[model samples]
Target: MNRNVILTCAVTGAGDTTGKNPNVPVTPRQIADSCIEAARAGASVAHIHVRDPETGGISHSTDHFREVMERVREADTDIVMNITAGGGGDWTPDSEDPTRGGPGTDIQTPAERHEPVGELLPELCTLDCGSLNFSDMVYINTAEWLREHARLVQQAGVKPELECFDLGHVWFARQLQQEGLIDGDPLYQLCLGIPWGAEADTETMLAMRNKLPDNADWAAFGIGRHQMPMVAQAMLLGGHARVGLEDNLMLKKGVMATNGQLVEKAGGIIENLGGRVMTPAETRERLKLRDPSTGKIVGGEA
Candidate 1:
């Protein structure tokens, strides 16, 4: 295997993992600290998502995002921060009226979904493409909504990581690219192993990866037990890999893992495969990322 890879640490997700594992960070400070530790453990990027401090459920509050960003910035770590713009899409049909949302729904407009990303303007933010039955609940991301969010992300001068959960989602992402909704070399993230979406197997991964645009920069991740295997699979297939407590909480069966541990484990896997992990600076250069302030690729790489 080639010895050059980028490892992203999904520090904390917006999932309901807090109750399942007490080690999952709930507060902004805790999330920021976990990201810093992961960065120190060979992660080039930290994919972040904040939760309600009180309820521990997913939240898209600008205040919470600001807190997390400020804390991470204050630490002066070189890790590239990638905040999620994927929240507020959950919906449960009304038990009485199937056409309407039920009490558990948290649907919002595209503008509402972009609020946090607009506020933070992180180096990278996710843009989930297409919609699917996310397990029992529906993840509603209509084409109209995605176009609006993509425009906002472009205007903010942030790189939008196109997140595709299935083959159709990848096709929709390509459509967005064709429409010029996204800017620069499109960055895609193939999300696998979620229920009712793509499975986390080599065949599924390859099929999705082969469909990406020729000039695209992309990464792939698998949830649960498929996480580590996908790490090596992605590396061998000429793409980056992501791992963390958010995707897989266990280091082994019945054993919980911290964000740092997950990153370190992925790093070891990459190294063992003869791939050298890329640092954040190297990743920024390879991806041709512009300094948000200067609006040009920094460090003279471009």
Candidate 2:
């Protein structure tokens, strides 16, 4: 069992979850406040994804990202900022003309997807390692696209959290490592319980965990009801944990939860399992994360 775990709270995802849960932050102020609250509640890292305030839909606006980052930094908190570079991958074919992109299709080039991370220079950013059938929509991130994205991320001096949705994603992530695309020891987030990707079970988690590089700093999260259970399971299997409104909305069966509440609950679970949640400083040291200001990999507490 891992005695120390890094707990990351994905404050506001690029999902249509705002209407589902009242606490899902939409505005930049709200998202930044949630991140601060999660940090205070024992989340070492805050994974952020901005949304259009007016529509409550996922947005790729750099201004929205900037405002959120500004607010979080102004709060004087120490949570490691992990911005999402996984946007603009949704593809839903048009009903009228199946040949072209439909109403739900939003695809961007590698440079476009890397724009926010490149400009903002956060400590860490996510790189969805492969594509998958997300529900009825197809999330596209082809091999050539991933290679280009990986190069862009490497140039920016930000650590890319290789988000593996399935076993093949893990395999491709390893290939990226082999090709010298990823830098440092490599950080992996084994995203589980997302429909048609990887299941939220011990066998599946273990299988993915076994496939990771030995030097990798990895974490896992399960969506919906599988969230908390995966927190415990990840800790037991010697990996870090992740939780927030992004992956789950309920504190329990019928109770809607805020991001801070979810982080507190995950921290409690980790502590209860004879493990302690690592602070942002500890996580930075462990992951060899780049400093937000200097863009240099740091060793000790900042």
Candidate maximizing lDDT: 2
Task: Please report, as a residue range, the 10-residue window in candidate 2 with the lowest summed lDDT.
Answer: 293-302
Candidate 1, residue 208: CA error in Å? 0.4
lDDT scores in order: 0.88, 0.93
The residue-level lDDT of candidate 1 at 120 comes to: 77
RMSD of candidate 1 to true structure, Å: 1.7
Per-residue lDDT of candidate 2, residues 178-249 (tens digit):
999997799999999988999999999999999999999889999999999999999999899999999999
Clashing pairs in 1: 3-275, 3-276
Overall local distance difference test of candidate 2: 0.93
Q: What's model 1's overall lDDT? A: 0.88
Stretches of candidate 1 exceeding 4 Å from the true structure: 292-296, 299-302
TM-score of each: 0.96, 0.97
